[model samples]
Target: MGLGACSTQGPFEEKDRGPDRPVDTSHVPDAVPRHEVRTAAGNKNPYTVLGQTYHLMDDETGYREQGIASWYGKKFHGRRTSNGEVYDMYAMTAAHKTLPIPSYVRVTNLDNRRQVVVRVNDRGPFHGGRIIDLSYAAAQRLGFANHGTARVEVEIIVPGDQPPAPLRAEEASDAVAIPSGEQTYLQVGAFSTLGAAEQQRERVSGMVGYPVVIHSPEELPELHRVRIGPLTNTTEVAEVREQLRRNAIEQTHIVKE
Candidate 1:
């Protein structure tokens, strides 16, 4: 066997990232647990990765562990996984070295206590003693995609077992509807003078088609606020923010009023 370093993933795969303004994945549900036949495709035992041999688990009965979790995105998206299935970074899936291929596990982010069920269809996370590797969407839902790594609890989920609702008892419900006429804005810059604000306005105006405005608060007459807004939603704000970020404009905050 001419197996090179880490068959499906390369050393630099951690550099993977999602879209500039990540798509709204809140609507994307977690992988529903289901029974699957164990196949020999990715279950070859005693596999070697970078000279270290790892054996696959014969079964996942009562398997549970805690360790660091990282996510993979565009770098491995659309690629063939260890089990001969296509890797989708947006899907609820994960890779584990020892777990049986096609197993289901409920991963709870220890940092945020956010939990999500994912299908383990691949093998890896061969670097950094990480116990598991999650897809980008799974990491996003766990609230640690940006931080790069998070402490997590991974427990095998039996098929047909109702996946736990991810809500926390103390967590305030987000069912509150946005007040009608509420608008979102991006506050890009602020200055002490109108001239500076207008100059920055002209600069940011050419950056995008979004409306640019300058307002001076009555309480702080000396303060000139330069903002781009009443944008439709967070997605548009994210796009504008990314565009500004690319132009070396890192100082931006959302404004909802």
Candidate 2:
């Protein structure tokens, strides 16, 4: 998702921009994480782009990194991506240099703590310092479309490993199913600034009556996470989740510690 068009394994490369009358993608649903069979269309082990050679990973297992992210927009809209899928700037898709084609990645904007799961269907971002290229809609959901670029953490998501969610929307990767023999928390949200996290903390505390707290992990000190409960059992987790549902909170995520 290099802006406009910096590099591609195939097709035209040109300058990019938003649509003349851009459609609002603020509420675009995330691409659901699924077990997609990798294809050879864009997963070339050794590929050359802009005089540099890159090797695509056989799979995205255990892939995680933090770096700058750019985006692509209207300029390449409707054009075929490196993987043969038509580029839709408004879709929850992305381009990556090495990740396997069709890998689902969770990208968290380090500046605002906004996150989105994007399907990697193309190759690119030949630019320096950028780790991933996101679709316009993906960038918008991550709260960085207007800024053009953002520092972000990209983590590979294994769909088959995630517990099935009975309380959350089927299309959302936010919440997960109950677990056994493990401690967990309900993460209502995350923010970059302390003020924002505190505001959410106040609201969530009043809603669930659980021990709501904000934690900034050492690995990502800038992240202010708003979590509720260290529910020891599935019964407690279900009780808290029922209360959350009563409070109309549906975007809850499971944080297994």
Candidate 3:
């Protein structure tokens, strides 16, 4: 997909950060100084931000409740987020202020009871009253893309526990269902500088409609490409690819890892 298409199709534009545009935090917060820590002698990779103590997820980690949910797309297509991944606002991913990255959650639009399963990949909904942010695809699945936001009940779905199947696309509001096929994921972007990648992560945190995450190269320890999706199969890749193209991110290449 080309950036032009992604930009024109979505509600927000990266350059058009609204009149009341909030302060941008792409640069590291003043509190987090730049530093590097060493690992065992043979290890060349230094520990980045992953070790910072985060709030613990505990028994309190089951189903969650009421709050406003919002959808984001286009404006942040290629921007780095706080979590170190480039944002793709069109996948079945999301952002939650406290949910652990990569955890699964079931989001229900309480007004319509329309629901969708999403992965918690990034941190956010920093705006008051907003509990979650879904990708464009997830919003459409829940029947809210045209309306933009909705009151919702976000339930934390334990990985092995599948909440009742989310209302099918036709049953919801004519939104398209992710086609059934082989499971796959796609790499969207990657950077040698963790800070740069994180900038893209934060940019998407506010605009995505599903669980969007930023994984550390350290954790996956490979080629280090930023990725989006728990895409059920390869067929869905084209739709996702289109969204990326529309966002002006035409160079985004597909990678199984």
Candidate 4:
């Protein structure tokens, strides 16, 4: 589906009976990490669609989120996606609003606990309340093809990151704590105006429940940095980064103090 104009209606209304036939999904494997050279074409720093502008993420490390997911089927088949690749409904690919094109993400269906890793190569679902848009085959594998939408979790799979082991019943409810000495901070944005910095600090503090501080460096008195920390570790930093991204805060710098 084109990110610029994603329509709910399919061009072939009659033949688009969904992926009703059983097809071999053995070849449809999860997206693996490789040394990818990013180009400037589809990796638009700031792109406008339907009048609203979106800023793409510079890195996909540690990005995770939970939201409603929708899918595109035969309607967009054979069409070129935002990344210039021809859209294949049967491929394990997806469209994300702000994720870097060609990134890999692990999508989990919350309702059924089914998971599938998909390569994000396009931008969209622009419709309200949807986070990621999956291909028809992906949706079928996740068991949401018949339902049209599902509550899902999308987590970025960085290179060298191992797949998480299944959690036991007791372990699922426990929180993972970072070591005391390993704390870090992520400075999400900075502003020359203290009010702007305070406003952002307050907004993000409410979202993550962590102390969002306005730090003014002695060397750079004019700059007020809006920072969130002391994050337990890199994992926490990644989780907070994803939360901030959902709130439209994209620019961030990890700081070790």
Candidate 5:
């Protein structure tokens, strides 16, 4: 597949980032321990492309904002994603349903005021309410791994004069909402060794509330992965991604589930 050329545009500016802030997971309540629950139980893996009709807007460029954001990991690590790439769960990445492949967005965590830039590479987080699904590492940077979710803001960043249009009402309405867990998901990071993946998992576990898990990759057998959640709400997902960026772990992307 040919990579769409990114127009030569303005210089990429590094956003202002504060010092590393840590979330105390020790006080978290009734939370499942890291590596305790192997899979997100009763959670149906979403992402069925039903071949629904979609419209193309003449205006394919602009910025947008959505609600909360969440994340995923473990269960999908190393599997072949919809985009045909292996899932990583540990790397800085995300999931979106309709955005163009390899687009860039700045995710801001509203709660603590943190932001992370993520590449839109894949589709999903179809459960609803979520705009983006981040990886374990990205979630840690936004400080949402502790609380499991966060209110976030997602704004698109495109080159040249063309920016992607916002999700139309019909399209947005047909899109999934929160409370549903079966939305599409994105996985980040595919390491050649289990030990390397584990190192990333360990790094995230210590920084936030959630415990990172090592998922055995099916397609990329030589790789091990780390991931976070099955977030359906786009709003929540966007928020969480921003927070993770503020805390650190800024190099992230969005992968379709």
Candidate 6:
């Protein structure tokens, strides 16, 4: 979500440290749509924020909207997101008021015809007249980061089948194990730099006392992922997640390994 602000200077006024330095966009790819489960967290219907009520859609198939889009940066970087993951302004991700927390969407800057696919992972842009919030890097790629806001089209990219039924908190304790072929892990954080990823891994491991592994895929070597367990059963998954919550870690995802 874009930072909430009463005036041109938004929230995190103290942390707004000038313009962001230019970075290498050579390896910055657009978000790719893939089949993923809609996380149980952040999907509550009729949720309220800042005295405003917003209802989440039961399903986002074919969802599309056009309006003002804004980008957020520095102040919120590295902060825990609405979903249980750290916010990375450089990543091709976005925040919407109601879309499923872990869904993918294609965002297009109407004026320039520049389009980018972004993962929707957080909620916001509560400011008046804004439809969605793009990451700083996403806005840069769209050619509007310096302008603050732009006219854009946001469309959901639905995966083949509908996501699995949302799991309940109580059911997590006794939930059956997923098939061995579909082993899952809780992805806590991802970073473009291995040093940053390792730091997060150490922090999370110390907090949850779990053996966190840093996985850098051969194909996406730039992305260093910090994950915990090939957790076989949902019960163990729930327990570890709870520990993370207690330690104030909110951004997380159940990813198939």
The lDDT per prediction is 0.74, 0.75, 0.51, 0.73, 0.49, 0.74
Compose the digit string of candidate 4's lDDT tens values, residues 142-183: 987767889999998875577533543323444566667765
Clashes of 6: 5
Shift in Å, residue 239, candidate 4: 40
Q: Which stretches of candidate 5 lie over 4 Å from their true place?
A: 1-60, 159-257
Which is the winner by lDDT between candidate 1 and candidate 4? 1
TM-score of each: 0.59, 0.61, 0.44, 0.58, 0.44, 0.60
Q: Can you write out model 3's per-residue Cα lDDT over 5-32, one digit (the tens) per residue?
A: 2222223222322213221112110111
In the range 67-118, model 2's lDDT, one tens digit per residue, is 9898888778777888777787766889988888888899999989999989
TM-score-superior candidate, 2 or 3: 2
Model 4: residues with Cα > 4 Å off, grouped in runs: 4-27, 163-257
Which candidate has the top score in TM-score? 2
Top candidate, metric lDDT: 2
Q: Could you tell me the lDDT of residue 30 within candidate 3?
A: 10
Off by over 4 Å in 2: 1-5, 8-15, 168-257
How many collisions per candidate?
A: 0, 1, 35, 0, 63, 5
Stretches of candidate 1 above 4 Å error?
1-13, 161-257
Error of 3 at 181 (Å): 21
Residue 99's lDDT in candidate 2: 85
